[model samples]
Each structure stands twice: as structure tokens, then as C-alpha cells.
Target chain A: MWEQIRSNQTRTLVLVVAMGLLLLLVGYFLGEAIFGSGIGGLVVAILIWVVMNLFAYFQGDSMILAISRARKISPDDHPRLYNVVEEMKIASGLPKIPDIYIIDDPSPNAFAVGRDPSRASVAITSGLLERLNRDELQGVMAHEISHIKNRDVLLMTFCSVLLGTIVILAWFGSRMMLFGGARGGRRSSGGGGGYATLIIVAVAILLMILAPIAAQLIYYAISRKREYLADASGALYTRYPEGLASALEKIAGSTQELKTANQAFAPMYIINPFRSKGRAASDLTSTHPPISERVRILRSMAGGASLAAYEKAYQEVRGSGRGVIPPSALVGETPVAARKAEAVPAEPGKVERARETSDLLWKYSNYGLVNCECGTKLRVPPKLRGSSIRCPHCGRVNPLSSRP
Target chain B: MDCPACKGVVVVVEYQRIELDYCTKCYGVWFDAGELSLLAERLDLRGAALDVNQIAALPEKKAAEKARGCPICRKKMKKVTLGSAPEVLVDVCTRGDGLWFDGGEVGQVLGQLKDKGAAADEQGRVIDFLGEVFHVRG
Candidate 1:
């Protein structure tokens, strides 16, 4: 494990340095065209780029949060969620507690942002809270905390920014070569080296186009491996690989799409938001290991006392006809089969009605409430409200103001 | 525009010919749903937060108008107001369906409710202290 971590560290460092070098090359080439490559001009352009990127680094959290429509929650507003995050923070030994944010979207996803744990924030969608049980929720939360613990949040952000700059430079180079070069030639009255300049510009454009993409493939490779590392570490942290594995299954099963998501925030999710379902893991372009593969690994981890036993058991479990029960179900005192047999019928229309109510409440609550029985104290799903809820404890449903 | 549910004002900001309606407090957007997608085809549109203000000049008849059923509950929904802010009343379905916020109302309603909760906490503390002095527990 240590050897793998060392290898991963080496790989990530190489990728970051490669990205940096790519950015520098693109910057230099673009700079030479815009401002003749005197030492002073080069310095001035590089300085400006660095200064601007630095500003983005400091304010990036706020800007991203706002753009994503994530709203902040105080501990007073969401005690359970606040407490969960607090516990995770302590367990992970983070210097400061990250702020929590709630997105109204119904997608079962979460992400961490900020330059590091000290400045980080975690955001979860209402759908995630609604769908996941307490243990499953813990598993997912642990995975995100693992990202913070491993400093992947900072690393991914830096990689993304650098990659973005490279892409921009590439685009600028292409646009200039296609249009600007001809104009430049017109201005220079067909100078002897004009065609040579055009060829350089064309080659520069091609390199520029290819550079960022190549850099991003490297970025995704590093990012994907970090996810696998976080998954392993998170299971270690919670002592329950099945918990996260089950959570991932639920996340996979959920059909609700995240409305606020774009390519930029896609990598931060526990599962890739943009992933096409049913694709095989052997396809290397994927930003995440295939869900099936991840679940298989986790189930293997859950099957035995030692990692070797886990591997052996995992192979058997995969090969044998026995389907792995969800970790939560398996962890319960009773066998899941007995529980299934003992399960009560849905009281006629009750299940259907509840499903309907759940959907309606889900959309209206911005997917916030889970089991709001009119006679029960409007039971919301546990955690992640970013606000307080009323109980139907007395069977007297209190009218809540929509204004508030 | 005010959120029909919360009565918080919604603001329309213009960049060129396009207009967007956004709520300051709740951050919920009001468009004809897919209209924004169409608008995004040409313009670089993003949300701009608005500040809440009740439209005092609107007729009281609009205030009296009630939605027929809770959108989520399929049952009657009630309009309730926070004690601290009598002017703002929200129609909470409470039956596990969703609560509606007028286009601009979500923020004010949520903000005022938070303040009301803080006030309630203080009052509860005082009441508990008085109960201790009086030995009121059965």
C-alpha cells in the first residue's frame, strides 16, 4: 500500500510539473506573438498571468459556490449535518471545519472545494440526503473527507486552473493562426518570411490545441487514482467498505440529474457526474474506475479479516452465484432474507401514495424532506437540511410559512 | 415580481435584450422553465442575487388569493406568518409536498424564519428558567 502511495505521489508530481511546463510553453509562445519576446516583455506577460491566476486562487471558492447556486448553512440551521461534518473534521484532523453548503438539485452527489482543508467547503445535494441511510451517508461523507485528508481538493483545483489556461492559450493560438496571421501578412506587405511565419503559426496552433487535452488526460489519470485511494482510505476510516460501496450503488441507481453541474465541477463528485452508464472499466478514458469494479473491491474488503482473504473472497463472491447484500443490510443483526420475509406489505395504497407524496414533497422541498408523515412530526430525512424542520409528533400538523 | 408563495420581491435585471428574474434570499429562479436554456444560446447568462422588498402598492386582493391545493400534498395548504415578521406569510404544504415561493420570496421567507427561530430559542430559554424557579414540572 505504501509503495502504491509512493508511486501515486510520484505520478501526481510528474503530472503537475508537466502541466506547469505545458502552461509555460503555451504562455511563452502566445506571449512572443503578442509582445515581442524580449526578456522584459516575457517577464511582464508571465507576471500578469501569475498575478491574475493568484487572484482566482484566493477567490475561487466564493466564485464557484455562487455560480453553482450553493447556499451556506449555519450549525444552528442544520444541527445534524453540522455535527456530522464536525465529527468528520475532528476524525480527519483538519485544521478548521469546512463550511457546508446545500444545492437544491435532486442529484445524489457531493463535492469538496477550496485550496486546502483550511479553506475547504463541502456541498451536498438534497437528493443525496433523501436517498441515503445514516451509515451510507457516513460512507459518502468519509470519502469526501478522505479527499481533503489526501489534499486532492487543492491538487485538483491547481491542475484544473493550469489546464484551463493552457486550453485558452491554445485557443488563442489557433484563432490567431487562422485569421490573425493573414492580417499580419497583409500589414507586413508580403515580407520574405511571411509564409514561414504562417507555417510556425499553424504548427503552434496544432501544438496548442493538443497540449491542454494531453495535459487534461494526465490530470484525469491522477484524479482517477486519487479517487481509488480515497475510497480505500475512507473504508479504513469508517471500518466499513460496504457502507461506501452501498452508497455508490444508491448513487448509481438514482435517476435524478444535477441541474447545476457542468464540466468544471464534474470531477469533484464521488462518482463522475458526466459518466455514461454501462461502460466497461477497461475503457481507460474514464475519470472514475467503473462502478462495478469499485463495488467489487469494496465487497471484497468487507468479506474477510485480512486484505488477502478479501481478495480471495472477492474472487469467490464474484465467481459464485451469491450476490453480495448491501453492507447496511448485511450489518444488521438479522439476516436480510429473514428481514425480507418479515417485511410488511405496503398497506394497500400506502406505498404508492407515499411514493407519490415523496416525489411531490421532494420537488417542492427542493428534495429536502424525506418521510414527512402528516400525523408524525413532519419527519424529514436525516441531515443536510441547512434549516430546521417541524415534527408532526402530536399528530397535529402545524402550518409552516412558505415565506420563511 | 413577488413569489406567489412567500411574497418576496423578484428582480429582473437586463443585459442587452435579455431579462432574468432572481430572488435575493432563496436564490430560486423564475423562468418559464426551459426559457433560460433557449436564452443561453446567445448570451452568457448567470444568476444575480436580488434584495427582498414587499410590493406594498399591489392590491390586497392579490394577497387574499389562495392556491387551491398544496402542490405536493394534494391537500389544502395553509398560509402562516412568522410572529416577528407579520408582513410575510408563507403557504406551507407540510404534507411532504413542496412549499412554493413567489418568484422572489424564497430568500426573505427563509431568512425571516431563521430569525424567528433564534427569537424562539431565546424565549424558550427564558421560559425554562421561569419553570425551574416555579418548580413547574409535573
Candidate 2:
């Protein structure tokens, strides 16, 4: 396990340095076009990298939450969700119950973010909460909690930043080469070493075009491996692989787009938020291991929900242990008895369930929930006139504005 | 978000995975453009599918006259009937911001979709898995 962590650390460092060198090289060549020298571009590239890193280190989670329009929720506001989060926190032995956030989007998805467990936050789309029952929700939260415990969140944070910068630098370099290179190219061509200069320029341009893509591939590689580990760890923590496996089914089946999701950050999610159905994991552009493959592995686990069980299932499914779960990261656990069918209640009817779900959301948003005498319940928004509301059910006017 | 019908404070609501704004004062609900479709599709009702394309193709029963301003952008919203049953007349924002349903109207729309969607759930593999895993018998 220690070796696995060490290898991950080494790989992350190598990936970042490789990306940085790509940025520096592309900057140098594009710098040549703009300033007739690579020095200025190299300096700017370094500055951007430093500044972006500083920003990401300090404000990355906040920035991500803000962009996703995720809002913090009080425990009292959504006890059901808060309870689930607290359960995972205890099970994972995380120092603090990570802050919980809710994005308004109707897409079923969830993710965790922070440099470490103490500062971490878990954000789930409203859609996910409405879709998953309590145990399923527990499974999903467990996955994110495992991510926090494993420091995968921190690692991905670093990778995402590096990927962003490399892509930006390459884009800026191409634009500069196109508009600013005519004079520089002409002057270099007039020199005695014209052909050599031309070849250097060609190679620089080619590298600039490919650098961003190369950085993304590396980013995806690291991200994909971490996801499987989180799944395994999460199942171990919950002692219910069925919970997460079932949750994945619900998440994968949803077609709604998470309106606030940015494509680059899709890796942080439990499932690929933007992934279309049936996309193979072997696709270089995939941000997650295939959902079908993952679900199959989770279901295939026998014995207890130990890391060993997960590893064995992974080996059977993937045909090799390779990079799915890092070697030795799995700790043995006493597998609890399989939960009895009657131990968990069947879900309520759709209308009742929907009403309960709406009440949950409304309570968090400070909306008033009142049941009419005619049996119709109303969710009143905080901003509206809290006055007389006619029941669409019985056509009897209910006095709601009487409340101060 | 303000309620389109009663101009009262609106609260957010969710069902399945689809979220909409509901008014406290008038009990009206709002579904952003594409949200209704999203909600319907998420319900995954196979028999009586109420997709966006189906709703768009419905004959304009009510004209665009007296269009209400969009709650988000306040543009004049066009009125359109929902579903094949020609159910509630939803005031749709021309800018595609969302649709406005008077109090109880959302219930009507969802109730119908749910009926159709219910038949489809009989074969849902996920639900079957949940039943097996959780020990729910149907």
C-alpha cells in the first residue's frame, strides 16, 4: 500500500513536470514568433503556471463549487442527506464531516473536493438525491468519502490545474504563431540558417498542437485508476457493494446534462458527468472506467466487502490487476452478513416519494411546506406573498398570507 | 425565482432527478426550458412518452396573445399545451427560459406522465436489482 501511494506520488510529479516542459517548449517557440526569441514566452508561461497553481492551491474548491452553483446546506435543512454524509464520515474515519453542497441541476451526479479530508466538501446534484434511495445514497456518498480519505481529490486537483495550463499555453502559442510569425519567419528566413530555423519552427508548432492532448491523456490515466480504488474502498467502508453498484445503475441511466459541469473537471465525479452511454473505457478521451464494467466488478465481489474481495473481482473482470486498484492498497476486512431483504424497506409509491423528495428540497431552500385541508400540499417559495392560496385540489382558498 | 402566477416567492422542488420552482403563494410551478422534457425522460415512461419533440409538434391550441413575461428574462412567453392529451396550457418563455404552470397544474402534468411511466418501470433492471438487493418484493 505504501508502495502504491509512493508510486502514485511519483507518477503525479512526473506527469506535472512533463506537462510543464511541454508548456515551456511551446512557449519558447511561440515566443520566438512574437518577440523573435523564446525567452519572453518562457517567462510568461512560468508566471502563468505559478499564479494558477497558487490560485488552485488556495481557492480551487471554492472556484469549482461556485462555477457549479453549488450551495451549502445546513444539517437541519436536509437531515436525510446530512445523516448519510455523517454516516460515511464515521465509517471512513475522516476527521470532520465534510461540508455538504447541492447543485440545482437535475443530472444525477456527485463529487468530493478539497486538498485533504479536514477541508473537504461533497457536492451532489439535486437530481442524484431525488433519484437514489437512502442506502443507494449511502453508497454514493461512501464513494466520495473514500476519495477524500485516499487523497485522490488533492492529486486530481493538481493534475487538472496542470492540464488546464498546458492547454491554454498551447492555444495561445498557436494564435501567436498564426498572426505574429510572418515578420519573425521572414527575418529568420533572411538569415544564413534559414532551413534549420524553419525545421525548428515546424517541430515547435507540431509539439504545441500535441502538448495539450498529451497532458489530457496523462490526466485521464491517473483519474481512471483513482476511481476504481475509490469504488473498492467505498464498498469496503459501507460493507454493501450493492449500494454503490445500484447507485451507478441509476446514475448511468440518467440522460440529463449537468448544466454547470465543465468537461475538464468531469473526472472528479463518481461517474463521467458528460459521458455518453456505451463509450468504451479504452477510449483515450474517457474520463471514467466504463460503468458497465465497474458495476459488473462491484457485483462480482464475494466473501466480505474487503479490499481483497474487490481486488479478486477486479482481476476476474479486467483480466489482470494492472492499474484498476493500486497494488497493496486493499486492506482486509471482516465481511458482514449480506443484508436481508426485509432489513431494507421497499420504496414508497411514486407520488408519495416525489412529495417527500420535494419537501426535502423545499426545506433546505427555506420554502414553506403546508398541507391543505383538501389533502393537497403546497411548497411556498420564500420570496412570494405568503397570503391566501386557493387549493387547486378542492378549489377552497387557503389563507397562507396570515403568517408574518 | 419568483412565481409566474402569483408573483410570490418561489421555492425549488425536485422529483425523480428533475427540479422545478414552486410558488408558495399561488402554488404554481415553473419548469425551465428543456426541464420538463428532462423530467419526463428521466421518468423514462416508455408507453406514453412525452418528449420535447412530441410537445413541440402539438398543434398550437392557444395563440401567443396575452403572453406572460418570462420569470427569468421577463420576455413575452408563448403559450403551449403540454402532452398528447392536450393537458395544461403552459406559458413557455420565448427565450426558452422555462414554462410556467399555475398551482396544481404541475401535479396534473406529472400525474399523467407518471401513469405512463409507471407501466415502463415493470421491466426496469435497476429497480429489479434494488428489489433483490434491498429485499423489496415489487
Candidate 3:
């Protein structure tokens, strides 16, 4: 595992550096096209990169959570979710349990974000909580925790921020060139260097257009592989591959789209947020590997829950010689037997699960709950100025302010 | 979410895990994207009466009622008729945020589901629930 982490860190560094170079190159050309000197653009690019890196390092997780409209919850809010996370934290040897958050979207999905395991947080949709059972939920949590443990969250954070910067720079450059580049080139061309200036502007425009696409390609390339690793690690953590396989199956089967997700943040989710049913498995641009393929690989891990077992299963499923896990990490790794499904006491039924999830949403939304004598629970919205609400079921008036 | 018609804060009324945002003053109801289906599924109404996709696909209706903004997106919602015999005009967010039923419209539209010959028991349960929930004194 340490070997895998170290390799991941090295690869992340290489990728970040490569993306940085791309940013600088785009900057240089834009500078030359506009200012007739590459130095100015290169300097600005470096500054942008540094500031963005700092911001992503310090505030990336919060930004993501806010964008997804995720509300933080304590153990009292949802004990089952907290327990699963706690169990995964202990199993993965994490220093501290990650903060948990829930999104109100009906689409089932989850993701992890942080600079490190200690500072990490896991967020799942309300639909995910309502749909998944104990073992399946554990499987999903383990996968997210594996992302934190493997430092994939940090890598993705940096990559997304960098990608955003490049896209913005490219957009600004293209607009500037369209409106002002010709004049700048015309002025420089009058100085006996008109042709060269025009050519540089053209090249700059082309590079500006291609830089974001190139960055996205690189970004997607790095993200897809980490998902498989997380799955393998998640299975190892829980010693159960079927749990994750079925969880993935359920998530993919849902037709609902996550309203808060955008292209930049789509890759951070467990499954591609934008993916619909029947998408081809080998889509090169997708941030996630195909759900069917991932489930197949996980289900093929029949031997046990171990890095070696996962690698064997992965190769067998893919019918390739290459292994997903690092060779060093697989060395001397013995297969650990898969655990039987735990019979959680008094497991809530589907309706109960749905109620619990909605109750949490109501709590976060500042809704006041009023239990009617006829058994219908009324949730008054916070902004409701009325002192009393008539029960929808029993037609009994329930006073709001008198509860305290 | 505020009621699209009354522009007043709406209270959420939940029964059997189906949450409906109801306004106290106007007795209007706001059904976020999937909640209607949830309500229908809970009532075991297998018909297309409450289908969001079908309702959204309904042609825009020219009405005298003033357009209202969706509480979630604040976009101007389109007026569309829901039922055939006595068309109940409702506001649907162009962005698919939700459907907004004006005061008494929920009962009027849901009550018509019985005419379509959907299972009487299921239709009766939903209509009864909606009628009891949205019952407001003039």
C-alpha cells in the first residue's frame, strides 16, 4: 500500500508539472501575440499557477462542498453513515475520521475531497443513503476513503484548479485576440515585422484554443485509473468485493442526473455525474471507467480481498498482461478471506430509510417537525410565518411556536 | 421554497416519506422534480397523470394568470394545463426545477385521475390525501 501511495505521489507530481508547463507555454504565446514579448505572459502564467495552487490547497474542498450544496452533518444527524465511515477509517488505518456531508439531490452518488486523509471529507447524495444497505454503503464509503488515503483527492483538486485556470486564460486570450489582437499586430507590423507578428498571433490563437482541450485530456487520463485503484483498495479495506460491485450497479442503474454537477467537478464523483445509460464502456473522454466493467472486475475477485487478489481479478477481467496495482505493493500480499454480510440489527426498511434521509434534509433546512396525533409528521419550512399549520393528513391544526 | 402563486414561504407537509411544500395562505403546493413521482409511486398510481416528463412535455398554455418565478431558480415558469376535462393550469419551471400547483389546483387535477380509469383504490387514496392536505377555507 505504501508503495502504491508513493508511486501515486510521484505520478501526481509529474502530471502537475506537465500541466504547469502547458499553462506557461500558453501564457508565453499569448504574451508574445499581445505584448510582442513572451516574458510578460510567462511571468503572469507562473503567478496565476502559484496563486491557484495556494487557493486549491487551502480552499478547494470547501469550494467543492459549497458548489455541491452539501451540508455537514454530525454523528447525531445520521448514526449509520457515521458508523460506516468510522469503520472504514479504522480499517484503512486513517489518522482521523473524515467529516461527512449530504447533498439533497435525488441522484445517487458520492465523492471525497481533501488535501490529506486527516483533513478529508466524504459527501454522498441523499438518494445514495436512502438506496444503499449496510454492506453496500460500507462498500461506497470504503471507496471514498481509499481516495482520501491514496491522496487522489489532493491530486484531483490541484488538477481541477489548474484546468480551470487554463480554460479561463484560453477564453480570455481568444476574446482579446478577436477584438484587439489585429490592432496590436497591425501596430507591430508597421515596424517592419508585420508578417511575423500576424503569424505569432495566429499561432497564439490556435494554442489558446487547444490548451484547455489538452489539459482536459490529461486530466481525464489521470482520473480514470485512480477509480480502479480506489475500488481495489476499498475492497481490501472491507474485505468484501461484492458490496462495491452491487453498489456500483445500483448507482449506475439510476436515471436521475445530479443537478449541481458540472463538467469540471464531474470527475470527482464515484461515477461520472453526466453519464447516462448505454454509454459505451471505452469512452476515452469519460473520467470514470465504465460501471459494468468496474463491477465485472470487482465481481471476478472471487478468491479473497487482497491487493494480489484484486490485481489477479483485474487482469483476468480485462484479459491483459498489465496489473492495476503496483508490483511492489502486490509483493508478498496474501489473500484475506472475504467476510460474510453483516446482519445489522433492526435494519430499516426502504420507507424508513427514505424518512431518515428526508428528516436530515429537513433538519439542515431549518424545518420544524410537528408530529400530529394521527401519525402524520408535518415539517414546517423555516420561512413559514404562520404560528400554526393544519395537518395534511388528520386536518388537525398544529401550532408551530408552542413546541418549545 | 416559496409558493409561486402567493410568493409566501411554503411549509413542507410529509406523509409516508412523500414531502409536499404547501403554502399556508394560498394552500398552493410545490413539487420538486422527483417528489411527484414519489407521491404517485407511494399511492401506487401507475398511470401517466402525475408523470413529470409527460407534464413537462405538455404544450404551453396561453392564460390570463400572471407568470410566476420558480422558487428554486427564480426563472419565469411556463403556464401549462394538466388535465383534459377541466384543465388545471399550473406553473412549471422551464429549467425542470419543479411544478407549482396554484391554490386548489392539486385537488382539481388529481381528482381527474379517476376519470382516466386508473386503479380506483390507488386513485382514491391519492385524491383523498391531496384533498385533505390542500383543503383551505375561502
Candidate 4:
């Protein structure tokens, strides 16, 4: 598994280099067909892409955060969450503490964004804070921190910028073809022209049609591997895969679509924004693996299993009939291996139980109004005001007041 | 000076009262958030509510002010737009507490929310009707 992860990283690095060379080669050839292989024009386009993409990459964080209406938080405002990040940062050996931001969204999701660990930030929805308990929160935070520590954020952003450049270039090339590139072609063709113009136009069209999809595929492959890497690294940080496993369960339950998230930032989120499609279990086109597989892996890690055992278990679970579990409460001990096997030959009654438990857990985590005073937690509904309640442990009469 | 919605806490900065009633999750401003209350009291609620659908037409501009911590932001909220509709502007605490709606903006925002709720219901009904109508044809 270690060797696979290492090899994957090496492979992705090589692919990035190969992609750049391929793009340059194509650009050079196309430039020749139109401009008679003028190195100046080819060089100019490369320079422009480098300049524009660098500028976008540098400012991308602020732009994305502003669009989401996320607000920065100081450690004083959210101490527990701050502490969780601090712990993860220390464990991950990251030099600086990443800034924390919270989206005022009532959806359970979090994503890490930035060019690198030093510049990176993690944003979690208010729903995540309200839904997951301390340990689970740590699990989720650890996952994001893992992304940063592994430099996945930087790699992903670079991939996006490169992909965007390819798309823009393709679009421009297509526009030139339709509107007449022959006019421009004449200037550099040295009057040996018509055949060069036709070939250039045809090839330009071909590249334009194929580049974006190819870029997208490359981006997805990189992204999916990074997610797997992060999952593994996150487990190493928390040393309790169940924390993340349970967090995934809770998040998977809601299925409330994020209205604000668009495709550009959608891939960064823990779960897909289009959860309403009942696509939680399907990893059809997504770069990220299925949440069920992630949960299964995490659970196995939590249960103190070897990596080989986890791999075997994961493959077994995937082939079997059991689909992803919806949001369920963490009540008792459920080992990863056991869950994977149970998922394999899921009994009819157990499937019903999984659904029921998930529904219950979702409700308990979301709508329960728990107000703690003197460390005693009281869960009350909106209508239960003015009721005389006693603390379970302290024997003190705790009257419910709307003001509090 | 008193915030009308949650009535939890209020802070006075620059001789203006700022109230906090905003929930962290929903990020919806509550009535007690200062300028909103003043605006609501001065304006006609029914008229403001009727104009709710036009809330998106409001203008927003950053106001020049020195730092004075808002009870919500726990840091000074630079005077930001309070109402997006009927174009009322107010001070907002940076910390996401509550917004201070100027004059009639609060009532207008409430009115807009009501209109939105109604619009949503109307849309739902249309969809349901279409579904039923299409069901018979299919």
C-alpha cells in the first residue's frame, strides 16, 4: 500500500510533465501551420498562460472564499474547533497553523483550499459543527489537514489552472477557425499558404474538441488518488478511523443539496453537492472514491487491522451487494471488518435497521436543541419552554427558559 | 437601542445600540440587531412586506467608519448593507451577529421573506399540478 501510494505520486508528477510537453508540442505544430513555426508566437502564448494562470492561482483562495460568503474565525470565537486544527497541525508537522473559516451553511461539509500548506485554509459548514461531536470533528479536520500536509491542494489547483488554460486556448482556436484564421495565417505563411491554413484549422478543431475532456480525465485521476492518500494520512493523524467513519455516516445522511456550490469548488467538498440524486454510493465519474469505501477503510484502521487486510476487505465489500450506509448515529462498537463483511451479505432486516438507524441519527444530530449548563446536556424541542427540568446527575431543578 | 428579535445581548458603540439575535447556522439577522429595529418601528410593516419581492433590487455600499466592536462580530462591523430590498443600508458587525437596518429596511426584509415564502409555495403548487396533469397523460 505504501509502495502504491508512493508510485501514484511519482506517476502523477510524471503525467503533469508529460501533459505540459504534449500541450507545448501541439501548440508549436499548430503555430507552424498558421504562423510558419514562428517561435515568437508560441513563446508568447506560453508566457501569457503562465502569467494569467499564476495570477489566478495566487488570488483564487480569496475569490472562492468570498463567493461562498465564508467568514474568518479567530481561535477565541471557536475554541474547540481551533484546538482540533492545532492538534492536527502539530501531528502533521505543518509549520504554520492554517486559518479557519466557517460557512454559515447548515450542511455538513468541509474542504481544504489554497495553493499549498503554508497558504492553505479549511472551511467547514456550520452544519458540520452542529452535527458532529468532538472526536468526529477531529476526524473531519484531520482529513482536511491531511490534504494540506500532503500538498494535494497545490497539485489540484495547478491541475485546474492548466486545465483552464487548455480550455481557453481551445476556445480561442475554434473561434479563430470559424471567424477566419486564414487572414492571420497569411501573415506568417510566406504565401505558401492555403494548404497550411486548412491543415492548421483542422488540427486546431481536433485539439479543441479533445483537450478539455482529456484534461478533465487527468484532473480526476489526480484528484481521486489524492483523496485516497488523504484518507490514509488522516487516519494516521487521529489514530481512530471510526471518528471519520462516523462523520462520513452523519454527513451522508442529510442529502440536502448545497444550493450555492458550483462545479469549480464542488470537487473540494467531502461529499458531492448533488447528494439528492442518491449518488452517495456511486463513484461513477467522480475522482473521489465512494464514501462507503472510505468509511470501510477508516473502520478497519480503527479496529487495528493491517493495511493488507483493509485492502482485501475493501475489494470484498465493493464486489458484494451492500451499498453505502446512510447517516447513522454512533451508539456502540462496530468494527470495520465486521461492517465490511456484514455489508457483503446484508440481511433484509439489517438493511431496514441501517435505514432506520440512519434516519434516527440524522434527526438526533440535527434538530436536537441541546443546551448545556454546569456540564449537563439537556435536549429540548422548540415548544418545551417553561417546563421544569432537573439535571440528571446533579439533582438540580433546571427550568427551561426561552431567554437562555 | 434595544434589539427586538432575540433580546440576548446589546452593545453600545459610537452612541448607537447594536443587538445580537443572529443564529450562527442560518446567518439570518434577527430584529434586535440595532438599526433594523429603528427602521422597522418607523416604517409601515405591511407596505414593507408587500415590497419584499423587490428586496434584491437594493443597493449596497461600504460605509467609512472607524473600528468599534459590534456585539455580534465582537469586532467592529464596518457599516454594511442591512436590507437588499427597497435598498435600505445599515451597519453590520463583522462577526456575523446582526445587521443594523436603517429606517424601514428591516420591515422591508421581513416583507421580502414573506413574499419569497409565498413564491416558493406557488412554485411548488405549479409543479405538483403539472405532475398530476402529466400523470394522466403519461
Question: Best candidate, DockQ-wise?
Answer: 3
Docking class of 1: incorrect
Q: Which lDDT tens digits does candidate 3 get at residues A330-354?
A: 7677769888766778988666787
Q: Rank the candidates by lDDT, best first.
A: 3, 2, 4, 1
TM-score of chain B of each: 0.29, 0.60, 0.73, 0.29
Residue-by-residue lDDT tens digits, candidate 2, A153-254: 888887787788778887877777787664467877577777767776776778787888888888887888788888988887788888999999988876
Query: For each candidate, what is the lDDT?
Result: 0.54, 0.70, 0.81, 0.55
Instruction: List, residue by residue over A1-404, the lDDT tens digit for candidate 4.
Output: 23233333456787677667656755655555545554754685587569766876788888878887777878766677799999999877778899988776545688888877788889887656656766678889988987887777777777777776776666666676567554446653566566756666667567668876777777766677677667665665676667788999988766445546766565677766655455545544576677877887666543543333344445455666432211121123232332222232532232232223222332333323333354434443343334554432244555555323
lDDT of candidate 2 at residue A383, scale 0 to 100: 57
Model 2 chain A: worst 10 consecutive residues (lDDT sum): A1-10
Instruction: State which candidate has the highest TM-score.
Output: 3
Name the runs in model 1 displaced over 4 angstroms: A1-8, A32-49, A182-190, A193-199, A277-285, A302-404, B1-138
Better of 1 and 4 by TM-score: 1
Compared with the true structure, model 1 gives a TM-score of: 0.57
Docking class of 4: incorrect
Worst 10 residues of 4 chain A by lDDT: A322-331
Off by over 4 Å in 3: A6-17, A182-188, A191-198, A276-280, A342-345, B31-51, B54-101, B107-125, B132-138
Q: How far does residue A43 in candidate 3 sit from its true spot (Å)?
A: 1.5
Q: Which stretches of candidate 2 lie over 4 Å from their true place?
A: A1-17, A277-281, A321-323, A330-342, A346-353, A363-371, A382-387, A402-404, B1-138
